[model samples]
Target: MAATLPQDIKLHTKSRTLELIYSDQEQFELTAEYLRVHSPSAEVRGHGIGNGVLQTGKQLVGIKGLEPAGNYALKIIFDDGHDSGLYTWEYLYDLCQEQENYWNRYLKALADAGETRHGNMIAKG
Candidate 1:
């Protein structure tokens, strides 16, 4: 079965979030940092299984714009110059459903790497 596509996609530049509104009254707001960190591009996802690169220093990143990629995905242009990923409808739906879990994992990974979302190294305590 095909994934359900959002009926509307809105980019809130001031808030730096992408809002997805579904016909079933479901809505999701994804932060630019969240989207950037979870980008499915080879730069973030890597060229193969595992070996994924960690994205840091994107706390204030914002979406510059978005372009539809055929009928399946969106090509997001970020202010930080990252416009390589194609965010498919299915992948986007998954991101929405797993937001909290994915966010938590990102935070943990950042801490483990002594990195801050603002692109700084965590000072040793």
Candidate 2:
């Protein structure tokens, strides 16, 4: 029994969420916007550590396509024309597990950059 393979995967387009059930019966609901902004692609995640791009204006981005990449990952195509990320099963699991910490960091980064999740800039004092 491997935790690397998803037992079931459902894409709820209307809600913009990806539901995953693992082999161990663990379940996770990952949002499209979360997947989009935190894409494993270098464009979003960066090719090196601490070089990730701060994605904004993706509050409404949708998942256009989901194609399997061998038995390791899935190739996600976003509605905004981003198709570079190869989201492996392990990566997805990590996203689900560390979602809270990661999201918090993202929000803090946005606020520090004076930008909102919608890409709007905030006025500084």
- Per-candidate alpha-carbon RMSD to the true structure: 4.8, 5.4
lDDT of each: 0.89, 0.84
TM-score, per-candidate, Cα-based: 0.92, 0.88
Query: Candidate 2 lDDT, tens digit per residue, 28-113?
Result: 88888899889999998787998888998787777877999998899988777889999988888899889999899888988899
Model 2 local distance difference test score? 0.84
What is the C-alpha lDDT profile of model 1 across 68-92, one tens digit per residue? 9999899998888899999999999
Candidate 2 residue pairs that clash: none
Clashing pairs in 1: 57-119
Which 10 residues in a row give candidate 1 its minimum summed lDDT?
116-125
The superposed Cα distance between candidate 1 and the true structure at residue 41, in angstroms, equals 0.2
Clashes of each: 1, 0
